[model samples]
Target: MANAVPVADFLVLPPRLDRTAEMLAESARRRGMAVEHLSSPVVPARLQHSAGGHLYGGPTFAAAVAPDLDLVPLEPADDWLPQLPYEYTHRDIALTTLGEARWSRTPMFVKPPRDKTLPAGVYVDGSRLPGDERYPADTPVLVSEIVTFLVEYRLFVLDGMVHAASRYAVNGRLDPAPLDACAHRAAVLDFAAGLLDACADSLPSAVVVDVGLASNADRGDEHWAVVEANMAWFSTSYAANPDQVLDVVLRAAGPRHRLTLRDQAFTRPPTPFPGTGRSGSSPMS
Candidate 1:
């Protein structure tokens, strides 16, 4: 009989590995996949020539190596959150250019929708946004009303299901807990199901969605709201099952040729200059 093919030829990590990356590497090894931690941002010629595999890293690192490795990194659409129903978002969200956003003088939560080039926070006003000199005036950003999250949970979703979940924060502080032990596990899953049913087309089959219990100051009530959707490969698993997280990561960033038609729209466009590499300074989380 012929030897069976491995799920992936390699599970690639960025040069500066983190505990999450190390943990994922161990998980990959246990699944009979070879792991490669690049020495730098540059993709080795050998890896570029070999059968492609999946990459696990942040946007910066993925941008640097994805073209050379032919990996397809999946991400949520820029307007996804803004288009979500108010029940799911619980806050006013808008997609606008940094140039236009600079005109706002009121407090608002602003962030670059697709990348971390701009610091995401509740800015006192538009003047606090990074100068147009640093980022292009036309850089896309998400502007939303500020809402405090009492707790935040990360759900690793596959095929519109919450495959694994972990509570990552409480009252804006890091506090990782497995979903099994979480008091709101049922509510979280239920909320996620409603969200997927409403707008699964807005996301890739494999992705991470963060939901939180938002405190509505005026209403004096707390309700579930989606914090945001993030690339599964770039998200921190926290206390989520490594195996389940890996399942999503593999599909989120894998050989480009294997990409499904539905996911084609979600794939990060290939870098124009595939050979130009940048430092892998970004964290996996």
Candidate 2:
């Protein structure tokens, strides 16, 4: 359904991800849908021009604050995630520190949280930071403690259904290979449920579960833990075959619940940036 013609509605990114929203829109139009793309207010450019604007027939389009957008509910029955959203540190520090441990493993995993996904190839460890490039003295870097794991998996859920699943070894060192289709499905289901429970208000119409290698990261290499929750728009199914994932996104408009976008503000207590210090730090501000 998502692919069949933009279906006379406007598609939009909630608080961010303009490029992604555009791509999804393009795919829909190609299938004969006429759609309009709007960036979320997270983008200054979008926010600047958001006020006093309108779009297609579906809903009022605006790059307003996240609270302003009417998102759909993803309420789960109970606690879904085995643990909290994966707490990750900087990749450079994660890699650099883990390297010091001499991991007997091969495929090491590295992920930066959604708030900081940028500058491609910036591994979790400090290894990615250039030796010469002086980071603003005020910038602070967060890195994950090196961890070993066993199985790796990916889950795709659309409109609350387990649409696609895949398993990976992620280069062997991580030992997430020999994908287990069934295990991945269950993991994804659990994750999707957790997302509904944890982020019911922010529950988007769609989402993809990026289950971490289900190995114990704290005990042995076979330990399993939740890695991080990623936005459906930001995640890519390494093995989303049959491509039904696309159609699900389209049909989602059918009886799909829409969360009212509350016009509020994202007031995060000011924190120091990466590198430098408050008393004597460089300035990017």
Top candidate when judged by lDDT against the true structure: 1
**Could you tell me the C-alpha RMSD of candidate 2 in Å?**
11.3
Clashing residue pairs in candidate 1 (N, C-alpha, C atoms within 3 angstroms): none
The per-candidate count of clashes, in order, stands at 0, 54
> Model 1 Cα displacement at 52 (Å)?
3.7
**Alpha-carbon lDDT, every model:** 0.84, 0.37
Please report how far candidate 2 places residue 150 from its true position, in Å: 3.6
Runs off by more than 4 Å, candidate 2: 1-7, 10-32, 35-111, 115-128, 131-142, 157-164, 168-184, 187-205, 216-218, 241-244, 247-285
Candidate 1 residue 89 C-alpha distance from true site, Å: 0.6
Model 1, position 61, has a per-residue lDDT of 82
What tens-digit string does per-residue lDDT give for candidate 2 at 63-136?
12222222221221112232244432112233222233223233334332332322323244445443333433
> Considering summed lDDT, which 10 consecutive residues are worst modelled in model 1?
276-285
Give the number of colliding residue pairs in candidate 1: 0
